[model samples]
Target: MRIALAQTEPLWEAKQENFRRAERFLKEAKEQQAELILFPEMSMTGFSMHPEKIGETEEEPETLNYFAKKAVEYGLYIGMGYVEYREPKSYNRYAIISPKGGVLTDYRKIHPFTFGTESVHYTGGDALGFCKIGDWTVSPFICYDLRFPEIFQLASPQVELIVVPANWPEDRVEHFKTLLKARAIENQCYIAGINRVGHARTSVYSGDSMIVDPLGRELAHGGREEELLVADLDLEMVWKYRAAFPAKIDRKPELYRKLADGMQI
Candidate 1:
C-alpha cells in the first residue's frame, strides 16, 4: 500500500484550524494515489496542557465525521490523532476513518506521557488493537509507547505494519529515528512514524516523520518543517525478512508467561 504522512504544524490548541489543515493534506495525498494517510498525535488540537482548549475529546466522532466523509470521497484510509472528551476524563486517541466512510478503529494511547501533567488530563489505553485493511494488518501506538518494545512485540507476527502517531519533542530527535529503525528491524515489519513541527507554547516537536522498511532502512523522512512524506510499502518483504530472521518463533513464551505471573525467568 502507498502511505502518506503529513508533517503538519498544528495551531496550538486550535482544533478547527488543524482539521482544515488535515483536509487539505488528505486531498493532496489522494491525488498522489495514496491508500492511507497519517497525521501526528493530537493533529487537531496541537499537544497542549490546557484541558479546556483541548477537551473536544468527548465528542470525537463529531470531529471525525468530517474526515470519515473525506475518506469515502477519496476512497482512501485516513489516520489522525486527537483528544477525546469522555466523561470524567479525556483520552489521547488515533481514529481510523476507513475508505467506506466508517469508523475503523479508535486506538487510545496506552502510555500517557506523565513527564508533565499529561496523565492527569488524559486517560490511558488498556489494550492494543490492530485492524485488517486491504492487504495490510495495521497496528497503532502513540508517542511515549515507542520506548516499550514489549507492546509491539505482543502485536508481532500478526501485524506487518505499525503506525506511530506522536508529538515527540525536539530534545530527543535521535531517539525518534533510532527507535523507529530498531522497531522495524527487530519486528521485521514496516514502521510509519508521523511527528509534528513548530514550537507550541509549551514545547517544540521534532518533525521527523518517516517510513521504515522491515530491514530498518528509512524510505522517507521529513526535516524540521511541515511536509508530506510518501513511501511505498512492500508486503513481500515483511514475510521475506521475518522468514529469514524467525525472531517471532524464537520467543520463550513459557518463560515470559511465568515472568508475567511474577515468577523468575
Candidate 2:
C-alpha cells in the first residue's frame, strides 16, 4: 500500500483554514496515487490546550465528518487526529475513515503529555485500538504513546503497522526520530510517525515525519518543510521479516510480569 504523510503547519486554532490546507494536500496525495494518507496530531487545531476552543463533541464531530467526506470523495483511506469533547474534559482522538465514507475506528489517545498539562485537560483512553485497512492490521496511537514501549509491545502480536500522529516539538526532534525507529525495530512492524511543522502557541514543530520498515529503514521522510511524504509499503515485508527472524517468538511473558508489579529494578 502507498501511504502519504501530511507534515503540515496548522494555523493556530483555525479549523476552517486548516481544513482548506488539508484539502489541497489531499489532492496532491491523490495525484501521487496514495491509497492512504495520515495527518499530524490535533490536525486542524495546532495542539490547543484549551479544549473548548477546538475540541468537538463526540455526538457531533465536525472534523470526523469532514474526514469521512474527503475519504469518500478522494477514494482514499484517511487517518486523522483531532480533539474529542466529553463531559468534564476531552480526549485526543485518531479516526480512520474508509474510502466508502464509513469510519473504521476511533482511537483515543492512551497517554497524554503531562508536562504540557495535557493530562489535566484530557482523559486518557483505557484500551488499545485495532483495525484493518486493505491487507494490513493497523494500530493507531497518539504522540506521547510513542515513549511507552509496553503499549507498542501489547499491539505487536497482531498489528502489522503502527501509526503515530504527533505534535512533537522542534527541540526534541531527534528524540522523535530515534524513538520511532526503536519502536519499529523492536516490534518488527512498519511504523509511520506523522508530525506537524511550524509554530504553535507554546512551541515550534519541525515536522520530522517518516515511514520506517520493520528493519528500521526509512521508506520516506519529511524534513522541516510543510509537505507530504509518499511511499509504497509492501505488506508482505512485515510477515516475511517476522518469519525469518522470529524475535518475538522468544518472549518470556511470565518473567516480565515483575516489571508490571512495581518490583524494584
Candidate 3:
C-alpha cells in the first residue's frame, strides 16, 4: 500500500485556515496515487490546552465531517487527529476515515502527556483500536503512546502497520525518530510517525516525520518542513522478517506478566 504522511503547520485555534492547508496536501496526496494519507495530531488546531474551546462532540462533529468529506473527495483513506468532547471529559483522538466517507476507527490517546499537563485537560483511552485497509490490518496511536512499548507490543501480533499522529516538539525530535524505528524493529511491522512543523503557543515542532520498515529501514522522512512524504509498504516483508527472526514466538509472556505484577519470576 502507498501511504502519504502530511507534515503540516497548523495555525493556533484557527480551524478554517488549517482546513485549507490540509486540503492542499490532500490534493497532492491524491495526485501522487497514495491509497492512504496520515496527518499530524490535532490536524486542524495546534496542540492546545483549552479543549472546551476547540473540542467537538459527536452531536456536533464539525472536524469529523470535514475530514470525512475530504476522504470522499480525494478518494483516499485519511487518518487525522482531533479533540473529542464527551460531556465533562475530553479526549485527544485519532480517527481513520475510509475512502467512501465511513469512519474506520476512532482511537483516543492512551498515554496523555503528563509532562505537558495534557492529562489535566484530556482523559486517557482505555482500549486499543484497529482497522482493516485493503489486505492490511492497521493500528492507530497518538503521540505519547509511542513511549509505551507495551501497547505497541499488544497490537503488533495483529497488525502489519502502526500509525502515530503526533505534535511532537523539536526539542526531543531525536527521541521521536528513534522510538519509531525501535517499535518497527521490535515488532517487525511497518511504523509511520506523522508529526507537525512550525511554532505553537508553548513549543516548536520541526516535523521529523518518518516511515520505517520491519527491518528498521527509513523508507520516507519529512525533514523540518511542511510537506507530504510518501512510501509504499509491503506486508509480505513483515511476515517474512518475523518468520525468519521468530522473535515474537520467543517472548515469555508468563514471565513478563509476573514481572509486571511485581511477582517472583
Candidate 4:
C-alpha cells in the first residue's frame, strides 16, 4: 500500500486555516496515488492545553466531519487527530476515516503528556484501537504513547502497520526518530511516525516524520519543513522478516506476566 505522511504546520487553535493547509497536502497526496494519508496529532489545532476551547463531541464532531468529507473527496483513507469532548471529560483522540466517508475507528491517547500538562486537560483511554485497511491490520496511537513500548508490544502481534500521529517537539526529535525505528525493529512491523513543523505556543516542532520498515530501515523521512512524504509499504516484507527472525515467537509472556504481577524473578 502507498501511504502519505503529511508533515504539517498547524496554526494555534485556528481550525479553518489549518484545514486549508491540510487540504493542500491532501490534494498532493491524492495526485501521488497514495492509498492512505496520516496527519500530525491535533492536525487542525497545534498542541493546545485549552480543551474547553477546542474540544468537540462525537455528536458535534466538526473536525471529524471535515476530514470525513476530505476522505471521500480524495478517494483515500485519512488518519488524523483532534480533541474529543465527552461532557466534563475530554480526550486526545485519533480517528481513521475510510474513503466511504465513515470513521473506521477512533483511538484516545492512552498516555497523555503529563510533562506538558496534557493530562490535566484530557482523560487517558483504556482500550487499544485497531482498523483494517485493505489487507493490512493497522493500529493508531498518539504522541506520548510512543514512549511506552508495552502498548506497542500488545498491538504488534495483531497489527502489520502501526501509525503514530504526534506534535513532538524539536528538542527531542532524535528520540522520536530512534523510537520509531526501535518499535519497527522490535515488532517486525511497518511504523509510521507523522509529526508537525513550525512553532506552537509552548515549543517548536522540527517535523522529523519517518516511515520505517520491519527491519528498521527508513522508507521515507521528512525534514524540518512542511511537506507530504509518500512511501509504498509491502506487508509481505513484514511477514517474511518476522518468519526469518522468529522474535515474537520467542517472547516469554509467562515471565512478563509474573513481572507484571509484582513477583520476584
Candidate 1 whole-model C-alpha lDDT, 0 to 1:
0.85
Candidate 2 wrong stretches, greater than 4 Å = 262-265
lDDT of 1 by residue, 118-154 (tens): 8888888898878877888999999889999999888
TM-score of each: 0.94, 0.97, 0.97, 0.97
lDDT of each: 0.85, 0.92, 0.93, 0.93
In candidate 3, which residue pairs clash?
none
Residue 187 in candidate 4 has what lDDT? 88
Question: Which candidate model has the greater lDDT, 2 or 3?
Answer: 3
lDDT, candidate 3, 1-265, per-residue tens: 9999999999998988888878889999999999999998988998888899999988988888999999998899999999997656699999999999999999989988999999889999999999999999999999989999999999999999999999999999999999999999999999999999999987999998999999899999988889999999998988888888999888898899888899655
lDDT of 2 by residue, 53-129 (tens): 78898688999999889999999999998888876879999988999989888999999899999988999999999
Q: Ten consecutive residues with minimal summed lDDT in candidate 1?
A: 51-60
Judged by whole-model lDDT over C-alpha atoms, candidate 2 comes out at 0.92
Model 4 Cα lDDT, one tens digit per residue, 118-142? 8888889999999999999999999
